[model samples]
Target: MTPQTQPAPAPSPTQATAGTRRGRRPSLGAVALYPATFLALLVVAWFAVTTTGLVQPYIIPSPVDTWKAFTDNPEYLWGHTLVTTGETLAGFVIAAVVGVLVAVLMVYSPTLEKTFYPLILFAQVIPKIAIAPLFVVWLGFGASPKVLVAVLMAFFPVVISGISGLRSVDPELLELTSTMGASRIKTFWKVRFPAALPELLSGLKVAATLAVTGAVVGEFVGANSGLGFVILQANGNIDTAMLFAALIIMSALGVLLFAIIQVAETLLIPWHASRRNRG
Candidate 1:
């Protein structure tokens, strides 16, 4: 009797690419190490360059100065942060609901798309920032204008992505479903809709991230509250430290909001691409 040997399987493209790309699955220590090292090097370089007087300290504050500023007026900064957070969240919710509805309508009626696509294209072309002042005049210096601006900023990508997702259903599968005497609604709900989901979710993620940026911009142009308002006030006061603090806060808020959307999308479409992502 002879013993047989089984050879090992080859590595997948993803596994090979993952090592080259993300590398080592990113443990918490590695996560802390990279940014800390980069920032440390950056700080050292900054200290050397500034101390040498190549760039004045007034022009670029030290990392220590920025840290001091962040801790100085934590209470005052917190209030403005809440305002910006509110605007970002409100606009994201509105955009999500409207984006999905518009996508659904567009999918159901090609004529609706023909009627509306040009309008959306035109709206997108007319830069939101340019008409931000007009929004103030029309909607006043309230949160409504800010929310509207954010919604406009986030809407287009979602619609386009959703439509593309809906249309991406496999033709053969659709034909098979149709031949099986499925109704248009039934086919779409059971087959096409599920098929389109991952793409739509991906688009939603993009839209969610953009919405935060738009909300901040809206507040910057017109409002007496929120981080944008805080930024304006800090600029006026020449309070560099507070301004830097507010900027950091605004960035953190954006990242947090984007993460929330990703979480929601994962929860909603748990059985889809995200599951494969976990695997």
Candidate 2:
């Protein structure tokens, strides 16, 4: 009689997902096409509306005028953009470091989590604009206030996502690590942190965009420089083209930060399900 053949073991969920992604992975150009098409359509509509006088040029400046505005004073705008970018980066770094630390502490200590979670929620709910003045008052009319506001705006998501990720580790895996005589720190570094990374990165992407907004809001409260200041000045002078240009630059800054975070996520968590799906 012929020897009976044994069936192969089924692939795990992660492996299966990775296999699917490998099969369906799209080219970079294919991935970019949809957004590029949409942008082209939007530009076309913008040109049509402006040229046809459907919207007053004063209210929404023509694309050509906006481009001219940016080109006319590129240096001035670039300087202010650099200032805002600095504030945003500073605040994001602080928020990310502090948020991760707070998350770790809360995870390790149930009492701390119970005590501070409500306060954190309350702080998040209060409008940043209302509190921006307080920061300006306390920190004065410099970059400090802007950075502080950015930290506040970007902190919540990091903490929430961190908590969710830290808690998501499998109990069985943790038990195995413990049985193998791994220290708590080792277990956390090797297993918990990696497991938590996907959620943490998601939160970080959101925080990155919010940091830009926070910096701008801080500028709105009382800043002499930054894109926000440029926007304010353009508004006051009724320079609609300059205002549109400033707004466009501000949006681009946020998108840039978001894209950087997304690249980081892709590099850091290539094995995560979300990344696999995107692949």
**Per-model TM against the reference:** 0.80, 0.92
Residue-level lDDT for 71 in candidate 2: 91
lDDT of 1 by residue, 1-279 (tens): 655576666788887566331243345576569878998898899778766778765566666677887687777788888887788788888887898789889888989989998998898888888878888999999998889988998888888888899888888998898789978889878988888888887887787777878887898888999888887887898776677778889778766776676667656676664444543
Checking candidate 1 for backbone clashes, the offending pairs are: none
Residue 79, model 1: lDDT of 83
lDDT of 2 by residue, 94-128 (tens): 99999999999999999999999999999899999
* Residue ranges of candidate 2 with Cα displaced over 4 Å: 1-24
How many residue-pair clashes does candidate 1 contain? 0
**Number of the top TM-score candidate:** 2
lDDT of each: 0.80, 0.93
